[model samples]
Structure formats: structure tokens, C-alpha cells
Target: MSASIPQDVFSAEWLALREELDARSRSHRLTGLAVDWLDKRSAGAPYGIVDLGCGSGSNLGFLASRLPGPQRWRLVDHDAQLLVHARRRGALLRDRAGSRVALETHCRSLSPMDRELLADADLVVASALFDLMSRSWVESLVAACAGHGQALLLTLSVDGDWAFLDRHGARVEESEDIAVRTLFQTHQHRDKGLGPALGGEGPAVLASILLAAGFWVESDATPWHLTAGDATQRGLAEALVTGWHDAAIEETPTQAARLGAWRDRRLADIDAGELGVTVGHRDLFAWPAERG
Candidate 1:
């Protein structure tokens, strides 16, 4: 097994830029799965949720209004700074019934995520996190949810497809772009704290794992379809291009010049408002297969 990456840090700006698209792109089918689970459950008391690797509480912001109210959430993350912001944002969550939410924060790493952490949670939710996790980590999560009879929703796991389109809605033919994407996919498997990150394979791998663990898994494509009119999407696309460029260069230093040229062309197209980007992702919802 490979050693984990130390201290994964995501800038606040990066989180803010991508969150809206995340919210927009999340699959309604998966949301419906979770909602149906909530509705079927006995509503004798407030529902409890645990959000693993909750970055800035975007999951809460997107889900609070949809889930049953009188909810209590435990938002967990390794970053103290993000926890601070999540705490502030979590306190403001309200369900559709206009009831105030109770929120708590835990600053801890994902390793050794024990049953105690999830003992009282009705659901486990995480956004944009599964791709950075190892297969074992996801299996562990599935096992934990099964053992405790909890439901789970994991959103925005990358599916490793990126399509760039010209103004006429046709795919652009760029060999350099394809090369960079291939290299970036290779880079995605590098250790990112959870051991050998699954990257683009997350959704499929996790669905299989959940099914084997005896959970009813529901999945849908949650791709971000970005065009020139969406400023946030454009900013996110630019950031994504820059990050991929850097990662590709780091992965293949000798090809830095080629990746640089590819980056320039992508950015130029963005500037001309002629670029369309589609990033593939998947949203997944799983519940206990037994449903006792």
C-alpha cells in the first residue's frame, strides 16, 4: 500500500467557485433516492446526518432545504479553517419546514473512521470527496453504513471525461489536449491521504462495492455542462485547466512545453467566449439493502 498525502488543502476560493456547479449538476434521481429513504423512515424525532470531509458545508447548504427538518448535522473535515467556515454556515441551515438546524463540527482525518462516529447518523453525505479516496476507504464507509444501517449519498465523483467544444457546438480536435487529460488521469491515482485515490474510477467502483455490501445503490450522471454565459462555470473551467496543466507538467516534466501550449489554446478559447466544457461526474445514493 502507498503512504497517504500529507495535509490536503483546498483554497476557499476554489471551493466557492466550483460549489454552484456542484449544486447545479448533482443528479435529481440520486436526490430523490435519498428523499424517499427519508420519507419512508419513521419520523419520531429529528434526523441526524454525518458529512464526511465536509468542505465549507456546501453539502449542508444544498441539502438542508430538501431533507426533513429538525435535523442535526455533524460536519467532519481535517482542515480547521474549513471547519470554522462550515460551523458558521451550518448554523444557518433550515429545512423546507423553516425549522432551524443544529450543527456540530469535527476536525479529524478520514482514517480509522469508526462506528462511533456514525452510530447515531441516519445518513452519511459527502460532496466532491469520493474521487480522492482509496477503494478500501470507500469499502470501509460502505461497511460502516451497513453495520449501522445508515443511508449514504456521495456526490460529484469524477468520471474522467472532459469535452471541449467550439462555438458551433462541435468537439474540438486537439491532440495535445487529449495527451494532457490522459496524463492528468494518471496523476489522479496518486495518494491523497486515503491511500491510492480512486479518482475517475470512484463512482463505478463504489457502486459495485455498495452492491456487494448489500446496499441498494442508485447512480446518475452529474456532469457540469459549462458554457460562456455562466461566469462561475467559466472561472471554474479556467481554474480546472490551470490545475490540470500544472498536474500534467508535474506528472510529465518533459512534456511541459506541450501542456503549456495546450493550456494557452484552452485559455484563449475561453477568453473569446467560444469554449464549452463538459466535465463528467456521478452522484450516488445507497441505502441498506435489507431495510429492516
Candidate 2:
């Protein structure tokens, strides 16, 4: 999986393609719960956030705008290049409330960090990240937050449910599509610097881990509902299809020819503006069961 990945998997183009989709797809219901928790936890004081696997700071820009008041964020990621982009974008974040914000970048992996990394944070969050983690990594994260009395928000985790809709709104049923998707999900579960990833099972696994650690967890489905009419959605759809095709072929070389044909068909659908794609994801928020 690592060898086949692009050096800039989280590039600016890719990030832009999915940002609005992520904004629209994220569960506002779960976000409301997170805001309530943030409100209560911050209690009119400054809010500090620690963003794990922060990527190019799209999460920082998105959350900073919605979350209220003065805020401080520590964006952590292993990619120095992404951290630079994140820092630059994070500095430009503006909110409707004209909220003030301070930003810092940490070029390090979250797994090996001490609990102190989250110690003074009011919230610990990550976007499109939990699915890349192992059970032990998530457990450590849950323990750190629970131990430190911090609220958690994790979003945009894939759940192994995806479908393509035709012009008639009927589900696109191609055998190669199913086979490729299965293979891609299998690749998703391989180690991604954290141990064997949880892949599509991420949300459920995280909920279970946090709940067992004595935290109250709330979750909501946040599927990317893509339509080819919009340019941004079209870009996202194209990129997603390309990514899935590449990963699928990489994982199952025997099926490359069949998957290539399937890829060509999906690309044609996108170009013809008749493709509708739904990629399943879940958003989660957790706080100590008993808040002080």
C-alpha cells in the first residue's frame, strides 16, 4: 500500500477536491454535539485544540471557522511539506464571528507522542484519520483523552459502503466494481505507520474503545453524496475513481485488465455527467461520561 501510494497523497489539488464534499458530508448533528461539548468544556475561556494527522490544515481552516471565540491549535502530522501548507492556511483562517486564532505546527507522528501533547487541549480531533489507525493506537488515543478530560471529534472515516448511481438513479451493478472495492478495502487495512489499520470498521471500533474507556460517544453517518453537475463534485468523483482503480489494481494484479475496463467506464460516466457516487463515512464525538 505504501509503495503504491503517491508521494503527495494529500496534495493541494486532492485536498481541494474533497474539502467542500467533506464540509457537506460531515454530520452536522454530530458537530452540534461537539460544539455543545466544546462550549461546556471551554466555559467562556480560550479553547485549545490538538489536531492529529492534520494534513494540509483543511480541518484547521474548517473547524476554526465554525468553532467560536479565541482558539489555539496545534496541528500535528508527519509530513513536513503538509505541515508547512497547514501552517500557512491555518494563519489565514477567518470566521464569521471574527474569532481570533493562534496556530502551531508539529512535524511528528501522533502515535509516539506523550499524553502531554493533549494535556492542555480542550479538544482533540482528526479528519479522515482514524481509519488509518490500529486498535492499539486508537486505544492509546482514547486513554489519553479520557485521562486528560479532553473532548474528542473524529470525522470522515470510510465504512466499506460505496455505490454508484446511474442516470435512472438505479445502483450501478458491475462485478468488477465489487471485486475492486473489496480489494481496495483490503489494502486500506494494511499498516499505515500505525499498525494494521481498522479500514471500514473504524467508527465502530473507535466507539467501542471510547465507550469501554468510560467516555460517552456519539456518531453519525457522513456519506459523500457526489453529483457530476458541480465542478468540484466532478473533480472529486474523477479523483476518487482513479484512486480506487489504482489501489484495486495494485492489490489484485490478476484483475488489472478487468479493473482497468471498469475504471474506463466510470471515467466515461463522469465525463458524460451521469455518475452519482456515494462513499460512506462516519463522524464521531466523545466526552467523558461524567463531565465535571
Candidate 3:
């Protein structure tokens, strides 16, 4: 990660966006995947886990509840407000479990305050975060953890590439879906500072990193299909798509008209009750124990 990393992505506005856009159960499809990965990796040892960039602690303490035996669960985030909510959730978890796990919270960006804790972590985890960071940041962090003998499990990497079938795909002819994709992708990298990734293609790239770093990667997936006509899913898709579009246009003004056209068409398709998009995701990774 460079000195210029847009570390400000965790600012108040972005935190609010996460609360709004990330589905309830706080995170819809990825929750179960996260729990499964952590549970299987802990072996018989007590779980020492930290939910990095944990928003509102929604899934943090909840993941702790599923693990039997001793568990030390920590919730961390750069957002102060989110940490307040996470602390409350921690308190609630302590009440229920009688503090069997050391429930803790750290309120600072991982850029500085978290390196120490991360150095001591048994399993470092995140969902939907890798997609939002640059390669340098990820490689550096993974190296740090691997050096410390900790495993990293990250999920919900956006593959950026989307599949729209022959029928609907044909509807996008003339400059077609290509332009919109280019723009949306451009926008994503710029605003998110994901740096040169194919937005949705991030998981595959992360997998390659895990492998090269000597961690055995176990990849699994669950898809979230959103039909815009459905209000809940529609709003999320719209908010995300629109933000992406805006990012794309930030760099290329020529994309303005084309971006508008795509948004309208997609909107119409959804409103007409046929708009659909799949939010792709995959999980499972292990930093296997080093042999003697």
C-alpha cells in the first residue's frame, strides 16, 4: 500500500453506505460462508478471531456464538460510530456467554493501530473487503500475517465480470454493454481505490495471491441474484450500480451519455419486471500450519 492509499473510504459517509447497502443479517449470503470458514479452520483449539472492518458488529459477535470452546473475539473498524454499535453488541454477547470469549473492540484504521493485534491473530478475516482494496495492500497484509503464522480468510470478492445470457445479452448491441461495463469498472477502481482489478474478478485474483503466499486456498461460492423489480434487492443494486456509474464517468466524460442510457435501460428492465444481476462471491482460504 502506498502513502496515497485512499484510506478515507471508511469515513462517515462510506460507513453509512455500508449500513444501507449491505443486506440485513447485516450481510445476506456471506455470513454463513464466513462462519463455516472460521469454524472448520479453528481445529480443536480455542478460536482466536478478529472481525476487521466489522460494521456495527452485526456478524462479529454472532460468528463467535457459533463456535464452541474458548473463543477470543475482537471487533475492529475505522468507523467510530460503527464501533459504538459493535461495543454494544459485544456487551450483549458478554452477557449471554458470560464473557467466555474476551470480547474486545479497537476503533482505528487498520493502517496503523491494528498491525500489532494482527501480528498476534490466529485467523484474520474479512467479508467484502478485499474487493475494495488494492493489490499492494492485500499482498502486504497477507505477507505480514503469514510471517506471523496467522491464516487469512477473505470472502465476497466482486468478480466484476457479469453474465447476462444470450437473450438479454443480444439486447445490448451498439456500443452495448461494453461501454457501461468499462465505465462502471473505471468508476469502481477510482472511487474505491481497488486499483486495476476487474471489480467482480477480485476473488480469483485474491486466490492466486493466497496460493503464491503458500496458503492453501479453498474456494467456495454463493450467488446473490437481484431482480430490480423487487424493491429490496432493486434498491441495493441501484445504489451500487449508480455509484459505480458515477465513478466511471468521473474519469471519462465520453461515457456520460452511454452511462445514462445503460442505467435507464437497466432501470426499465427492472421496472418492467425483468431486470436481473448476479452479485458473485467466493470464499475459503487457509494458511496451513508450517511443518517442522
Candidate 4:
């Protein structure tokens, strides 16, 4: 949410770094519900799915094979470069029925989200995206999907809970850590190309909206547990710390020195294989009540 922070967090490198973690953090329970709902649909026709902010098609990759085939996907994102990667990956996927999936990419902003986006989509999905959206935007989306009786699976919405853990998997709490986290959370509520962002309150707000709209909703925690022992996880942990530090500094410039020192200590602990990070996220699956 830092105005100075480059908006390129969606860069291919960053997306790639977090892809595996995202996949593992997704709730199997919510995914299973989504699969069951999709499977119950009439067969022989392609299942039309629209993925909002589909970065490099990670959601498509995670869900395509698990879902029923003859599948047709529309991967949408503002980043043309990320869409390119998504389209390329989509070409290689086959559905649960072993049929090649049909795919298309849309390089467009999700702001002013319209019913047209949900018009042909039987299921609308997005991953790690709702946290960056405003409440009004989400309401518009739920209304659109409900109007079409479309199911929704929104994944990896940060629930604002995170902790640095010690070797024994216990939280390592520090005053500065708390301070940095608070500032980072404040930064999260700032505009992110889409009005004021929902930040950590996304999942709960979305669920409430869905319920009010008469859709059945289910949500589960899908947290990332990164330990320093694994090379890949260690890298992600470091990146997370740096990103948090930058955001915190941007939110409170006066505390830049303190935040920097805190970041350095966290990074050092991570490097020494003495730290682990747990980031809480939520995965939600909602469908029109009539469908349930």
C-alpha cells in the first residue's frame, strides 16, 4: 500500500516465488466443495470458468486437473506479461477427464467489475486477489455472480494473522515485530489500483456479503508455514520480510530506522535457520443457495 512501493509485486518473478506456497496453502476442503459443485453440473459441455487476476495461471494450474473437463477458462489480469505466462501454462493442462482444456487470456482491469465478466462463466475464481479489492467492488462482484447463479472460489486472502516462529514452532514475539506488523496492516488498507483495499478483512467481509445475497459460503484457513531449512521456503521467507519492511517504512517513515533494524534481525534469524514464518490466509467457496 506504500505509494513508493513499486506496484510490480505482480511481476513474474514474485508470482513464481509464491506459486508453490500458494498452492499448498489453499484449503483442500474448500477446493473439494468447489469440485463437487462443478461435477454436479450437466456434462458434455465445457465448464466455463473466469479467473480474476489470474497471475501466471497458478489457480488454473492448481484447479484445472482437479476439475471436470471439457473445461474452458478465461484468465483475466491487468498485467499483459503475467497473462502471457498464464496462457502458455493453460495450453499444457488437461482436465480430470483427460480432455485438453480450452483457454483464453484477457488483459483488463477488474475495476468497475461487470456482470458481463460473469455472463458466460459458470464458476468465477480468483487467488490472492480479493485482499487488494474494495468492499464496494466485492459487493458488485457478488451481485453479478448471484445474478448469473455462478459459483465462486476465492483463495489465499490474508486474514491478518502472521507470526515468526522459533525452531520448536512456537511464536517469536518482539515489540518491534508487533509494531512493524501493525504498520504493514495499515499500509494494506491503502488503495491498490482498486479503491481502498479490504486487506486482512477481505475473507470475512466477502463471506458476509455472500450470505446476505443468499449464496451459501464456506471458508477455511489456508496459511503459509515457511521454515528456513528448505531452500525455496527460506527464499520466500526472506522476500516476505523485506516486502513487509518496505511497506512498514512507507507507512511510517519516522520509524524507518527501527523497522530496518527489525527487518535485519528477522532476516538474520531466517538465514541462521532459526526462524519460520506463518502467514494466515483464507480460502472461500460460495454458490447460489439454489445450487446447494
Q: Best by TM-score, which number?
A: 4
122-167: candidate 3 lDDT, tens digit per residue: 7777766665666776677777777877766565455565432222
Model 2 is weakest, by summed lDDT over 10 consecutive residues, at: 1-10
RMSD of each: 3.1, 2.6, 5.4, 2.1
Model 3: lDDT to the true structure: 0.57
Cα error, residue 103 of model 2, in Å, equals 1.2
Residue lDDT tens for model 1, 87-181: 88877778869998888888889886666778788999988877788888888888889998999998887877777776666677678878877
Query: Can you tell me which runs of candidate 4 are displaced by over 4 Å?
Result: 1-7
Give the winner by lDDT: 4
List candidate 3 stretches off by more than 4 Å.
1-46, 94-101, 112-114, 163-175, 191-201, 289-292
Question: Candidate 2, residues 87-174: lDDT per residue as tens digits?
Answer: 8887788643796588888888766646877867988989988667888888888888888888898988888777787766567867
Residue 196 displacement (Å), model 2 = 0.6
Ten residues in a row with the worst lDDT in model 4? 1-10
lDDT of 1: 0.80
TM-score of each: 0.94, 0.92, 0.74, 0.96
Query: How far does residue 197 in candidate 4 sit from its true spot (Å)?
Result: 0.4
- Residue 92 of model 4 has an lDDT of 90
* lDDT ranking, best first: 4, 1, 2, 3
Candidate 2 CA-lDDT value: 0.78
lDDT of 1 at 158: 85
